[model samples]
Target: MAHYRECPAYDVFAPNCPARLVLERLADKWVLLLIDRLSAGERVRFNQLRRDMAGVSQKVLSQTLKRLERDGLVERQVYPTVPPTVEYALTELGATLGGTVERLAQWAESNMPAILLARQLYDQCGE
Candidate 1:
């Protein structure tokens, strides 16, 4: 037996929409990087993630992980060991977003040159 409530329609453009809160979280650069990293479909150690995402401070990574976990986009697992082991992985919901984030990252990388040129032109003549 399954009981499902009808989900409400979300209008992200509405200032008062609850979806705005989620969009706000997803807009964060750290959050985007974390999501893009974990999209690989493997649980990664905290230290490994920190190493891979350069420029992320230890504190910021920790806080971002906590926030993602709270939002149901990440799963945190702990294994009892000498020093204890912790890893992060994407939840099913998060997995659904993986491809989208990956595409966004790729788009940024591929279009950066054009964007830079556009900015330069704007600065030089579009005043």
Candidate 2:
């Protein structure tokens, strides 16, 4: 068995670290948006996700959901039915991330007005 210490290159902070891959995955706009929308503990359907995420297209949502599933952050459950029901919920790992993401979302929401004001002021000042 290979241990992390045995690896010659195991710097997580390095730009190319495997850990960075998780960051990159979560850093996506759609992923963040979807995760935020799903934070309410709602078992969201594909169309529901599409509706909740304002600007996300079906292709993008599908791709984002697939990536999240691959990363073990999102759980996809399929039910047999006439139309074939599909639902998405956060996995245990995803729940952990959801809390963090929700906090970040709250921060962004709280500060956006100020940030926009600063941008406006900067633009007005030609700075």
Candidate 3:
């Protein structure tokens, strides 16, 4: 079977669409948070990440970091020390995503009141 590549905007269901793959990554709940955390371009240790990302289990963080690293968005460095320290940092590509996510976080912070009011109105209407 042959598929069309001429029009991506019209191929919402196309299995090979590049946009879909990127969207899948961006839609993950932790991607934005991880990106935001690494936005400062500072190397953060594994324990530090766990501390900052409250409620994220060690397993989940490991999996998410693996995925991000595979996608060229994050870098993992292992240093030989007394305990063999491990660090995670964002790559250049991830910083681009970080800027966008930062703006989204800011928007969420600024609009929470209005959003809550809208939600209250919606709940009242349903009742």
Candidate 4:
């Protein structure tokens, strides 16, 4: 069995590191939205994802789904039918990530009121 070599600290932070690619992909707007939606365990059609995501374009959504599938975070299923049908669902890895994203979302939601109040106060104080 071949053991994977541990990356040096410098290599880990290099721009070309594979870790950076994962971070960039996960931080994208469409990926974030899709992951959030899929956290509910409901398999969604492409059109349904577009509708639920609000501002995403068809092209962008298609790209995001493809990337997610490639990363093993999402599973794409094609139904056998005359007209053709496709659905997307999160894989186990995706589900684990969904929990982390959910926590971040919850924190943002919980603190939004405070953040708004601070913003109002700052505006009134001219700072």
TM-score of every model? Answer: 0.90, 0.85, 0.86, 0.79
Per-residue alpha-carbon lDDT of model 3 for 1-127, expressed as tens digits? Answer: 1354744575657766565767888888788889999998899999999999998999999999999999999999999998999999999888888889999999999999999999999999995
Q: How do the residues 1-127 of candidate 4 rate in per-residue lDDT, one tens digit apiece?
A: 1221343442647755566668989888689889989989978999999999999999999999999999999999999987779999999899889988888788989999999999999999995
What is the Cα-based TM-score of model 2? 0.85
Per residue, candidate 2 scores C-alpha lDDT tens digits across 1-127 of 3343443575767655576677889889789877878877878899988887888889989999999999998999999998999999988788877888888889999999999999999999995
Give stretches of model 3 more than 4 Å off. Answer: 1-15
Candidates by TM-score, descending order: 1, 3, 2, 4
Extract clashing residue pairs from model 1: none
Residue 8 in model 2: shift from native, Å? 7.3
lDDT of 1 by residue, 1-127 (tens): 0111222466766556677778999999999999999999999999999999999999999999999999999999999998999999999999988999999999999999999999999999968
Better of 1 and 3 by lDDT: 1
lDDT of model 1 at residue 123?
96
Candidate 4 lDDT score at position 103: 82
Using TM-score, give the best candidate's number: 1
The residue pairs that clash in candidate 2, if any, are none
Local distance difference test, each candidate: 0.91, 0.84, 0.88, 0.87
Runs of candidate 4 exceeding 4 Å displacement: 1-12, 118-127
